[model samples]
Target: MRTVVFDLDGTLVDTSGDLIAAGNACFRDMGLGDLLDPARDQKTAVRGARAMLRLGLERAGQLDDAVVDAQFQPLLDHYARAISTHTTLYPGAMAAVDALTADGYRVAICTNKPLGLTQQLLTALGIDGRFHAVLGADSTPTPKPHAGHLIATVQAAGGDMARCLLVGDTETDAKTAAAAGVPAVLVTFGPAGADMAALRPAALLDHFDDLPAVVRNLIG
Candidate 1:
């Protein structure tokens, strides 16, 4: 089956709020008083804990490896407690997944998020069963942009790598697809907005409703 690999954060859902909240929690504990802004730091939030922490510390004028190390686990702990509190799938996300599944595509996730947290969030969302496979940053020796991560996800899902497509919201995803020799469709609604087009992915997705046709065109 043709594979559809999705990036979890900005691509499939808006987890930016919770992610920023986690980073802010770390700052709050350090007496830094919530240095990150949800609206302004959404992009960093999607990039993962280190990016969020780095941005917050930079804004607080305390950017350093020691501070990042000191706060990393605390941030993750805070995030884990309320991971889904402010998270929500983008409009038409599940509908498109259902449509793709019905159309015989093997849907799965390949994210930079850690495996345990990814599974926890998926289970909390009650859609853990939707994906044929879910591979996280720690799932393989290397993650997205390294090719092996996405390839491993496809193989685990019993999918055809030659007929695979990646739906993501960042330059990293585009690079991953390029490395894997698959088409990458960058979503326009995420933190990168329409500017994601500058990454020059295989295609630009303005809406999830447009995805099925895009996938069909790319791999079929």
Candidate 2:
């Protein structure tokens, strides 16, 4: 069977607004000015919450590990409360996932988001049942940019790495796929910085609807 793995944050979901709100809330609680610019920081949100927090806190000179950790619970609380308040699947994300799953592809998620929150968001968005497996950063000993999680995901889906494809919007995802020996398709609409053309993915997709055709071409 073929397998397709997806990145959660920017690739599938437009979660930047919620993330920025959370960061702004954290800064507000600490009496610091907002340090995140949604336009500039949107891409960074795909790196996961810690990275977002680090970026904002560093700019405000408040990124001490202890202080950041101390603020973790509150930040999460704020985020959880507003999780879907500003989040939505990118255009065509749900349809693409559904079509891929219906076409007998084992669709799964491999994101750097924490397990609990990832599950929560997936469930909230009513897409939790779509994936055959979901691997969060905290779900394994190592996260993306490390092959363990991807390897584990492929194994769990009962598919060989050679028959699997990783879909994401970051260099980390490209590197992870390379390390895991799985071909990757980079999505241009996600949080990538350098031109995706430069990353030289197995394929580059501009829209979610383009996925099935790309996969067919890959596995044909």
TM-score (all chains, Cα) for each model:
0.98, 0.93
List all candidate RMSDs to the true structure: 0.8, 1.6
lDDT of each: 0.92, 0.85
lDDT of 1 by residue, 1-220 (tens): 8989999999999999999999988888889998888898888899899988888889888899988888888899999999999999999999999999999999999999999999999999888999999999999999988999999999999999989999999889999999998999999999987678788888999999999999999998
The best candidate in terms of lDDT: 1
Identify the runs in model 1 with alpha carbons over 4 angstroms from their true place: none
Error of 1 at 16 (Å): 0.3
Q: Where does candidate 1 have its weakest 10-residue lDDT segment?
A: 192-201
Q: Which residue runs does candidate 2 get wrong by more than 4 Å?
A: none
lDDT of 2 by residue, 1-220 (tens): 7899988887899898898888789888889878888878887776666777788889987678888778777878888888988898989998998998888888889988888899999989988888889988888999998999998887777767878889888888899999998888998887673567799999998988888999888864
Model 2, residue 185: distance off in Å is 0.4
Model 1, residue 6: distance off in Å is 0.5
